[model samples]
Target: MALRPNPTLRQRRVGTELRRMREQAGLGGNQLARELGIHAAQVTQMETGKSGISVERLRTIAAACLCGNQPLIDALADMVSERGKGWWEKYRGTLSTDFLEIAELEANAHSISTWATTYVPGLQQTEDYAAAMFSRFTPSPPSHDLDARTSFRMQRKEAVRHGKTPYASFIHEAALRMQFGGPRVLADQLNHLVDDSLAGRISVRVVPFDLDTFPGGGENIMFIEGPVPELATLQMDTAMGSMYFDAQPSLTRHRDVFARLNSVALSEPESREFIRSIEYEMRGKYA
Candidate 1:
């Protein structure tokens, strides 16, 4: 196949994993190229995700790198064989690459866990709530694009809903009370959460503002559990844009942080009641 000028996040990640294995084996790209009877530049292209590698070639490279982990090897093989377009591909030019990449990651994840300090997790947000939040983006997005953004988010929720992907959200109480859109919209959103939690596809937990302390400085996180532990991914948003981490150490730290946050959050039933109280308060105020 011809080389790709722009690779998707998943493609880049597959190449990155291969590079890691090669580095661990203490073999240079040039040396591996010699072993595989491919030009040195071709190896660089594969490592950078500019060129696609066949499933057979991926296995050969893994063996050459002295990697013995079957699961990891199988995962990479799957990446090599992944073909065709995903639903997110339709929005490639219409939306930012970051948005498309996020949807792709969530779609492929085995399960997802999130920690939200100021906003409801995207996969659980109602349409009006999301539109309100997006409208407040720094400098504000063009008014014409607001509908597209909201629809994209609503589609993202399907990632968890369809697969029964075991989504767990740890949201701070402040997020529940932020009143995005308005009191009525926020109330609707809170009520929606209660309904979702009852449906058993999602689990919601709240960390009350009264907590003396919180984990990770209440930073936002979206940890995507892959088919295997070694393939887990952590996504963090920054002032500039979203950053993704798949390295072992980064994944380990995020997993630990999520665990601590989960420990301090309210139980499912308790969280439902907490959200219900907030909904009642909002209804009284908004009515």
Candidate 2:
């Protein structure tokens, strides 16, 4: 098969874990190839996700490297296993890579948790709110592109919901107050949020403005849990680009930060009531 020029996040993850395993066992790429009877360059390609690896070869490498973590190995194998194409593939060339990658990540995630200071998380946004968001793009996307993106986002939300992956989120009160698409639109969005929270569709907690300190700045932080701790990923949307973090230290630190946010945020019942209160405020002020 021809090598993939732009491998999906899952494919790259398979290679990343393999590289980590090799390093842990103190074997270089060339050394591992010598032990596995493959060319040195082939080993590098496989490790970097440019080339695919079969399940049998993956197991062989694990055995050769003395990797005793059975669960991690199985997770890696599953990542590489042949599977049906995702619904997002249709939009592969149409939408940007970040959109497809995020959908793929959430579609496969065991669970997802997100934190946002000034905007609602995409998975939880209403259709109108989503469209309004796209309208704010730097140069303002053409109508066709905007429609395509909005449609893709709605499909993504449905896919994750159909998959029934556990979802939870923390939204600062400032985001709840920030008006997007005007007061009526934001009010409708908040109402939808309240309904979802009350219906147990998602666990959303609000970080009130009165807090002494709100860590992690104002950026969006999403933590996608994998089958195992080692596969967990931390993602952030930056001005430069989307940044994905999987290093042990990075994962550990972000996990801790989320824990702190969770603790500081309101409980489920309290959060629901709080969101409802905000919705009522919006309606009273602008309805």
* Best-matching candidate per lDDT: 1
lDDT of 1: 0.88
In model 2, residue pairs whose N, Cα or C atoms come closer than 3 Å (at least 3 residues apart or on different chains), thus clashing, are none
Lowest lDDT 10-residue stretch of candidate 1: 212-221
lDDT (Cα, tens digit) per residue for candidate 2, span 1-287: 68989988889889999999999999988889999998999888888899999999999999878899999999888888957888899998888898888888898899999998878888888899999988987999999899999999899877766678898889999888877897788889998888778878688898999888796757888999999999999889777767898999988888888889888998988877887887788788775
User: What is the Å distance of residue 169 in model 1 from its true position?
Assistant: 0.9
User: How do the residues 130-165 of candidate 1 rate in per-residue lDDT, one tens digit apiece?
Assistant: 999999888888876888888999999866687767
Model 2 lDDT on a 0 to 1 scale: 0.87
- Over all chains combined, what TM-score does candidate 1 have? 0.96
Error of 1 at 133 (Å): 0.8
Q: What is the TM-score of each candidate against the true structure?
A: 0.96, 0.96
